[model samples]
Target: MIIFIDSYTEEKLANSLAGRPGYFKLFYDTENCGCNGVLAIEILDQPLDTDIRISVKNFTFLVDKQQESLFDDALKLEADRSYPSFKVSSDSALYSTNVRIKDARDMASK
Candidate 1:
């Protein structure tokens, strides 16, 4: 699976973990954080037992089990100069890059 990380995000992650040793936890979860439906990215000092650690582009991602199905095959996360966040896309029609981040209240409508 090819997960593309933007230069900005990459630099940010590197800067965050430059001095710090050990593995930096990158949390990916499908939760309603705001109005739009989007994935959540969190940096943790430690890793959880249920976390799935994937190393891509010299960066580690801590994905949840429930979200693994969405990334079964080779998924790519492309990032450009304009885009600051990671863009996830897969060859499978079951999953799409059209995912939007939604808040708790917005999720209730769906």
Candidate 2:
């Protein structure tokens, strides 16, 4: 599968990832939500060894193997200027319009 991230989206993500030792996670949050789950971009400081990595242009995304089938072969990550979040979509469907960025870094220690 191929993931596309535009310049604007890259810049926005870079600003948050700058100097931070973390990995981008394309997470399918199903723990909270019912029948359908929500798609979110998570910045995790430590990723699980079982996580599958999806390489894009200048970055990589870690996703659960079980949830890998939820995405299409091609995907796009875009920036949402209206809010401090992002949007994940593809030609086949609009996954999430208001996809949130969850930074799992320890902010208290830093």
Cα lDDT tens digits, model 1, 48-89, are 688777887777766666556656556655443453444555
Model 1: per-residue Cα lDDT at residue 23: 44
Q: What's the TM-score of each model vs. the native?
A: 0.55, 0.86
Residues 1-110, candidate 2: write the lDDT tens digits. 67899898988888878777678989778886885777888888766787888877677788887778888989888999878888888898899889888787775578
Return the TM-score for candidate 2, rounded to 2 decimals.
0.86
Lowest summed lDDT window (length 10), candidate 2: 100-109
Best by TM-score: 2
How far residue 42's Cα lies from its native spot in candidate 1, in Å, is 1.3
Name the regions of candidate 1 deviating beyond 4 angstroms: 1-9, 15-37, 93-110
